[model samples]
Target: MVEFYIGTVDEMLQSTLISAFPIALLIWMMTKQRALPSHIALPITALLVGLIQLFYFHSDGRLLGANIISGVLSVLTPISIVAGAILLNRVLAISGAEAVIGRWLDSISNNKVAQLMIIGWAFAFMLEGASGFGTPAAIAAPMLVGLGFQPIKVAIFALIMNSVPVSFGAVGTPIWFGFEALALSPSDLLEVANQTALINAVAALLIPILALKFVVSGSLIRQNLVFILLSILSCTLPYYALANWNYEFPSLLGGAVGLMMNIFLAKANIGLHTTQNTLNKQTKVPSREVFFALLPLGLLIVILIVTRISPLGIKGLLTSTNAWLGIDIGGSHLGVSQSLVVSLENILSTSVSWSYKTLYVPALIPFVLVVLISIPLLNLSKTQVKEAFFETGQRIQLPLVSLAAALVMVNLMMLGAEQSPIFLIANAFATLTGDSWSLFAALLGALGSFFSGSATVSNLTFGGIQQTIAAQVGLPVNLVLALQSVGAAMGNMVCINNIIAVSAILGIHHKEGFILKKTILPLLVYGGVAALMAIVLS
Candidate 1:
């Protein structure tokens, strides 16, 4: 067993700052030097972290080795989902789905604003329901690009919108797994969901304004305020209601239902597309072509719904059983046993057991199924299939390597938090806030997502701390936890892995800093509102 070296707040603070050096270096190099994270920044940071653990912290090679191994293994599920998304995009691209989708958009709306609300806000909400592990942007950003929007804008918009629906991501994983893991009762769980829904509802309504002003004219936004207001309500109302009734279906049903309502309105040319413009000029296209174009998305949605809601326990069938291959390090092994945890004293409190679940993950079935069926249904030839696969393999090479390195840094920090910078940062925040921790509740939540690249992991890190702080400060535990959940959900907008993946998928290539700069605006707005709401609600 590794000895726990308990340090004073001052010593821990110094250690934490030193530990943060790697991250600071990464940011400087990414933004200032324009270096590729995968090739240069990330690898260097990982090495520096390893040295920090070994020399400064005196952590044994075994613990450091386990941390690296666990960190690499942790992203397998997301990496699998991303690979599927990339494959789906590549297949769709070669199959001429974009042309059919473009015609479909023409048939629906000529207005860029209208298209964004549908694709950026509503459509993404549905995908978020289906798979919350950063897969929504991978799927939705390309769709918006097909509609003639800038890839960067689409990436930013989707990333921001993705934050609001994340509490219910992958079928309420953030709440069901993140919060419930804290041992809250049913009543407490419901309360947390309720407050969380409220926070997201506010963000949902505001994101459209940003999407409009940025994508369209400000004058257009002012003219379409009523329509925009109604559109937001159309989504958020159903989302909040379903979150209370069944957290699993808010994004699923809310997104699907909201899309229908908005589609009906857009078809009538209600807002910016009130007159058929060049962007949405009517084109002669067959209904069958439209359906064929949408078949892949159709398959994805149907598979998600059936697996998610079926009483036959399809979700369970897919969710159970880990494909764990253990990592051996100094008599301690780490692996992907979803429910199993490996804890090392004064190191990671609980390291998740993980393995490549190519067969069981929810994303695998739809993406794989879509690709296989598309070969016949979309009339894809053998040449096209090989090309798509080859292209995807090449495109994903940099992102996978970069993502793995970044995740390693995060895991090292999170698992060894007592001796990491996060500990110092959290303490500093607590000291600064005192009785006012509620004010920064959401910001802290966002910070977790930013570091861990997951709202669920954010909750895992902060839920207990939030609950304890709430107790000491005389606030409702559920309310504070709700703020944490909502804040972390918003943090998804700026998660490092998310930015990198979005850039890579959209072919932006090493513009993580630029993406971060664009996204931080909405991150601020969302966090600001959550902070204010926390003050009142908590």
Candidate 2:
């Protein structure tokens, strides 16, 4: 049991993360040494973090509930959003919607560089906006596969591209939920989250293009310097600007703008030749044929946008209900309260708030959108529509299971950290890093997310610490916290659970290390860039 001079209950509660660190480190080391299987290592790591906290710390039910709520919410919020995107994507795939999109995109430009820009950069960002969970990888992976890239290479490229819109992903669920749980003032939290999201958006534009060009032809990158720099500048600038103006739509809107421009710009190419010919002339789905294939997807986007708009969209037409149920402890309710402390059995027992926004307008609209318009759109039959649903369901099985399991593991770890000595470790680090803390703040933020696998959790764990350190040292508080947010998101690339969930969906089993290996350098590079940004901003 670790004790500190900080007497406030909240401060005491936060100390647990500091206390839990060494134990977590030990577990991670042991897990690595044994090369424990994911299923085993995840649960074991989760349990150890929980047990260490519960026995060592004394907390009110409300404190405990806060942690629990976040876990439960993770399952529903971002995870559900992910499931919806997957289902929608799967539906589109079975109905040939992606092919439609591919053909439409191809018709706009036949050049390979243009195609890469569209698919890898623009298209990937759009998917990131609509459904970010494992979707960028899911959608882009197969698209690259269809483009003649090997399965593993496709997966890697998709994964690399996925990083761009992650901070604001899934309708801003991570930041949105993180603020609510931490009990921060909405405006301040939104500002920090949005700024950080923008920072990543800028990086998003540059990294993928550079990575792609480098991956394809390292020397060829020099030839397209002007176009590449412009592309990077276009996305990075607007993403940052608009993010501060409007948080929810930065990635969605910015990606859309950049992607549209990328299509046209890629038309007048320099001279970068891909080692592997991307276009499959033998299996290329024709342009006209591709349009019909894409009808359902176009309808999906339209329906999603329209329904949320004027008086007749999906929300106006659908009924709303509170589907969430869980134990109410202390001053907080179940799901919401559990988020404040450590998320324990939050996954299984935390409340589910049944809000009607997009998931429930009835699959009928999309179905009709697909079946009716798609007849002329894709030249498909009733049989194909039915097959799409079946295929979508089949593909969803592993991902959904992996999602649920991953959520449980995350919940358990949150609970453990809340009750253990790990939080004290966090406090000590914060203390040592005071004043010149932006870099360290970012590092701590990254660590919180690495352990918890959520940027919101990273903020919750370290937000107050950053603020306190700034106040004490007379440093710029907002800048440090902003850096914290950036680091937290960067941490997602290497977060074990997210990596595992994504890898499982792509059928790259028993290769968590490989995925982590791919992500580490990128994460470090991004983190270093963010630290530089923090210094400049500070």
Candidate 3:
């Protein structure tokens, strides 16, 4: 067993910082050098490190096995969902549907403040719900860029919007990976996660206004108080309500509610606000036509929700499918028991057997919906559709590479390190804080985000550390881990990897430090709130 090592406060701080420094340096060099693309750097690093584990560490088997599993997981589920989402976005983009939708929103209130509230907050959240793993940034950042917003601002806004839906992201991956895999009971896990989610939701309420200030400054906040307040309420209230009752659907349904609320609020305020010269109104296309053009997205949302929730909606189809996969666990060894295969006969078999239902689709709802809706709306020739598919394939290439590389790196580090790196680091932290697990949890949250390059991944990595520490200190594990995860997400706003990626996307080089400086407060605010929650709730 990997036991935690308690050390002096100075020692803990030093070790934690040192353990994190290598990854930090990589982030810095990638941003500074601007030589090789990160897509290439990441995999190269993974391979080099894996080689070290093989030769020097004498831990090649475990490390290599971890890499294989992580690699497979990267492609198997999350990657598929991301690809489907991007394909849907591409369809919308190609069809000029995005412009129409933007124009219609622009029509309701041409005021820049209103537009920011709608787009930065509501629209972004909707994308977060529909697709969580980097899609919000990929989709929303470009739209903001087209809106004449600064790229740095767009990146910042996207990151902020990205936080709210993270717990339920990618069909509940975080909750599944972080909480479910633990020793805790399901009800306890759900309650803890939901409470943590509610806290994050409340923190996210300020995002619209904060993003506006970052994008347009303080004046915009003052100018659109009603709209902004309403927007925040619309987002937080329903999100909290849905999360409490239906944790599975909170982010998904909440995003749609927020989007609709923004639309309604915008339409109601059609002539209420006087425009400032700095914030000009964008032109509008016909709302109904724009809505029609977005039929694919609407269809996607409907189908995903129905297929996931409404059993009767897909009951007959699910009943006839007998496809399933599972690794039969024996002793120390494991192997793949089934491989994924698709056949028309399998598709046909779904209509008559519920036992075979798991094989029926596997979230093909987005793929099917995108193709069906885009064909008519995009007015694409067969050639154009084929090209779109090709483009979609190309677009996912970097993500595919990045995901695989990230998995390999994470797995290697986890398996080959001399100890549970996080545990060693956390024990050092606990000793330093005199068993103040809140501080340790906060620090773990920050550390996990730094390493994993994702809040959700961070949660999965160090959640147990926080829980373990809290238990040792006789504090609440759920609250501490909850805070850890929330702070982890907040930490993403400033993580070197995230900063570099967003900076590059926004065409901002050398100003990453500046962007980090700007975001530092929000990160602190978010973390501070979570830390306070850990303290007060305890």
Candidate 4:
């Protein structure tokens, strides 16, 4: 195995620039006036990265093949999650449930700003915590569009609102699994959570304000300023407090509490001064109709909560791989289990592997289960069910390709060499920034998610690097990790895979670049605020 030597200044600079070219090309092609469609641009980018890995990085054909295979396999999780969300949207749209949901929201308050805060901000926050694989945008964007918001604006806002909750998203996977390789003590991990929550809490204030700008006029936002402040505090205060109490459940419970509080405030018209109640003249919806309309989503939330809370033991059962059958072929091992554990080990005779807990992934257990259960409960005709499935299949086609390409690019960059391109870039940043690396620490985290499409993956990829840099630079390690986590969460706004998924779910194709243009500002602001907060803590 040949390592690209970065032991000298010229070598480091050369390595960093060479490694960064693919990412630069990707962004340029997407955001240019003649914007390339994600499905097109992403594959081109992936091929470029693969070529660099093979040539510049001196990677073997076997390693390259393994990484490509791993990338394809890894893509299944996001694609399935997106597919399930699309299916649910189809079910809701076909069954008239979406209309009922829109009206239910209107009944609470017809103020568009209030509705946006409740659903896009608070509701999306809770969903991100419970099921965060781009699921929040998948669920919330369509709901907002059904309420008469533009699909493009809704898509942008959904992605932006998904940020603050992401570090603790999927029941804190970003912390627990993201830092698992660090081997931190429970106490240190808790401190990371606490600092992450504090940083997010500060960034949370600006994020809602920014997301609101996409959906509502500045005048309308000003009219509802007090209510908006309450809305922001409702989530962030509890979110911060919960981080102190435990590493998990800050986003989940904070969003839950915020949803309830915001609903009450909106209903009472507290702090809502001038916006007219547009639904006031409409007849009231029956309780049963609302219940049935909300049933599938309600069930999904319940299932996610039940399975995630460790005391319940359901998470253990679903994730357990204790019983399995093992086999070896082509110098690789495979494990198949009755409990739905599937593992592939030593791919192509390299120390690379993958595993899928069939029951544990949110795509299968919650999203897919909710869809299946909704069929009988929603009482859809066979034709309607077919239509839903057909539409879901159609919508997922481009996103599947784009996601696969994006993940392949990510894998090639991260796993193609003993010192991958990602590390080279991080090292370059640290070397260039030196004493001021604090300002750029979060940017490194954002860079990770920009390519990899996940906060958990971002933290896992860069956490050790951030810790090492912190030690070398005389900064606190936990604070730096927290900044990394927060920056990764913010990166969700501009993540190519997320942009692709949200655009797909909204049935708005070829506007990924436009969405990225709109979201990049928020990402910058979020990283800036988080950096300042980290510096303060330091």
Candidate 5:
């Protein structure tokens, strides 16, 4: 195998431009006036990257094959999660649970803004913590749409609200696994987590405000300003506080606390005085109906918490391989785990590998579990369950293509090793920014998530680069890394994969560009806030 390097300024400039062309092409094709659907645009963009890797970057077939295979397998994570969410949504609709849940929410508050804050912000925060891989949008968007909000608005708001909780999402995988390569001490990692939380706490003050603009009138927002303020504080305060203690549980616990407080406030009609009369007009929901309607979600949360909260010991058991098999072919080893973990290592005798922790992944345990449980709990009929599964399959067809192409492009770019396009782009930005890298650190993080669609992936890819740049520019490494985490979280708003997944789950097609356009501003605003905090903290 041959490797490429940028040894000269001219070579660096040339390589960077060549590397960026695929991403630039993707953006243009997807966001142009006559936008191409992601299913079409992404494959075309991926083919172009393959050409670039082969001709320009001089990648060999072995590396390309491994990356392509790994990329295709990677699609299973998000697709399965989306499938579970869609199935759950379908089951709810078929069993009339959707209507009951909607009425239950309305019964809490007739004010649409209040409902949006609870579901989109608080509820989404919890879901992100428990199940990060774009699950918040997949689950929340459908619920909001069922509540009569426009699908597009629900999608945008759900994406935006999902940001603050992401760095700590999936039990803080973005921090713990993301920076595993750096081998930072536990205390140092906690510091990074704390700083990331602080930056997000500041952004949280305005994120919900920005998200609300998409759903309600300016006057309606103004009318609920007090409730909005309380709602924002309700989540961020605990979220910020918990990050000081540990990395894993802030988003989960904070969102839980906020959810309870916001529900109480909404029920008590405090700060919702203007809408109290409308709430009064709504009929009360029977406790049993509400319980049955919410049982699946409640079970999901309990299971996720039990499994994810390391102290309970279930996470290790689920993630561990009870048995292992290793096979050698063509001087490469293929190791397979026999239990809950499925791993493929050294693909095609190359260094590339992929792993799927079957039980650790929320798709099987909670999401699918909830879907199965809902049938019996909600007393759903066999015909209804069949329809739900069929609809889920129909909705995911195009998204599967889009996700596969996007990830193949991402893996190809990433597996280019030192000469990877993404690395070159980040290097160029840091070199250009120099002393002001703090201002753009989050943007680099955002770029990683924009391409790869996971904050954890973004951090894994660029966390070391960020640390190097921070030391070279004499910035605090912890603060700069925190910025990376913050940017990655905000990147969720505009992630192409997330847009496609949400669109698929919402039963909307060809609106990826519109959602991207709506989301970019929020991403920018969140990035700006993070940059300013980094500067001030330093």
Candidate 6:
């Protein structure tokens, strides 16, 4: 194990300087360079950070290579989900589901504000649950544009709504993988989820209001106050309830049913009492086409629910690995590896993983199954199916590389860098804040997400540090961890991957910084809400 030093003030400052370079470089490049692809920025940053660790922190090169390899492998599940989301979205569009959804926009509400509630707020939330990986912004922003909303406003709403369900995103990947490294108990997971849900419960109320203000300058908010409250409760009540036992589905199920209920209200013209603009002239779509187009989404929901929640022993079968793959490089999850042991069970292994099962991840099995079934059910043409498959694969290539590199960066800072410069920063914050660290705990968490561009990575990077601080400072451990999760989720708005997703879908690659600027206010709102709540609850 690399020695963790608690050195002098000068040593601490030196450690912080060496460690902070890579992260600061990342932020500067992403915000300053208009055309630098994430795939490029991330990998280079990873390499640079590794070098800095070797020379400055005295980290071992071989171990660093192994950690980077592990980092690349660890992120496969989320990367697959991202690819699946993009493919599913392409398939839906090919089957006219995008158009079908657009047609329903006209039927739901003539008023733009009401329309934003359903699609941008509720429906976007649903996408965040179902496909996340920034897919919500990819889907919702274009849909809003089709409804005649300005492109900028569409992007803003999509990015803002993304904040609500990020911890539960990609079917709770963040919640699961975020704390997986720490190996927290299931009950602790629930407690963490409860705290995150509490902060998001406020978000459930506040997001729609923010959306309305973005749409019409808050004039229509009073007239639609009841509608806002209802929308909030609809997502909040079941969301909190689901967090109690089923951490994966609070956002998934909550967003799914919330979208449906909100759709029902909009179609029934329940929330259209105040505004009467058609938003845009759209043709009435046939119910058959809409249902067929929505087959993938419906199937995705059914598959996730059944596989994840059923007591019929379905998940057990799905989770079982016929073979275990083992890596020979000597490294351990606890710290450094000792040896590469042979697993006589079966032939399933990678450079980073030993005894890993085939399709061991929840996301891989369900999403792949959903895609195969969806191809035939959606009546997707051979050409269209082929197109969607190839297109999604192509689009995700750079993104997957970017994500892996980001994970590599995290692992580099973690595994063997002597607890990292980030840990030192956290320690300093804990010492500085003393009794009031709650105010900045979430900020640190947000920075983790911002730098890594993943809530799971953020959690993996900072969860233990934050936990250590909580224990040292006598802060509420669960609540502080909850703030970490929530802040990471909120960081989705500013994360490079998410920004790329939104901009890629809208065909506005240059507006990344512009989008970042507009979305910061909402991030502050979300961070502020979580911070204040953490202070009060603590």
lDDT of 2 by residue, 319-419 (tens): 34333344555433333121122222422243322222334332343333444555545555777756755654554555454444455555544443423
Query: CA lDDT of each candidate?
Result: 0.76, 0.57, 0.60, 0.88, 0.87, 0.69
Clashes (N, CA, C under 3 Å) per candidate: 5, 49, 5, 0, 0, 11
Candidate 4 residues lying further than 4 Å off, grouped into runs, are: 1-5, 278-281, 416-418
Summarize candidate 5's per-residue lDDT along 445-484 as a digit string, tens digits.
9999999999999999999988888887788999999999
lDDT of 2: 0.57
Can you write out model 1's per-residue Cα lDDT over 186-288, one digit (the tens) per residue?
8788889988998889877786687566566787777666667777878889999987767667777788888898887777656543443344344757888
- lDDT over C-alpha atoms for residue 458 of model 4: 95
| Ten residues in sequence with the least summed lDDT for candidate 3 | 346-355
Pairs with steric clashes in candidate 4:
none
Ranking the candidates on lDDT from highest down gives 4, 5, 1, 6, 3, 2
TM-score of each model, paired residue for residue: 0.91, 0.73, 0.77, 0.97, 0.97, 0.81
- The per-prediction CA RMSD against the true structure, in angstroms, equals 4.2, 6.5, 6.8, 2.3, 2.6, 5.4
- Model 1 lDDT at residue 334: 45
Off by over 4 Å in 1: 1-6, 33-39, 273-282, 322-352
Q: Which candidate model has the greater TM-score, 2 or 5?
A: 5
In model 5, what are the clashing residue pairs, if there are any? none
Ranking by TM-score: 4, 5, 1, 6, 3, 2
Which is better, 2 or 6, measured by TM-score?
Answer: 6
lDDT for predicted candidate 5 compared with the true structure = 0.87
Is 2 or 4 the stronger prediction by TM-score? Answer: 4
Per-residue lDDT of 283 in model 2? 51
What is the C-alpha lDDT profile of model 6 across 1-538, one tens digit per residue?
Answer: 1123477767876777777778777766766746455667778898998888788877766666666666777566556656666666677667777777767667656666677777777776766676565656655676677667777667767777778788888678788888887778888888999889888887667765775676666656776676667766777788888888877878877877787787676666664554464434356667887787666666765665565543656556655543334333233432121221122221122123323222434345555677788788877789998898887777766666777887778777765533576676666666667767777777788878776677887888888877877877788888888988988888887776666556545545356556666677888888788878986787
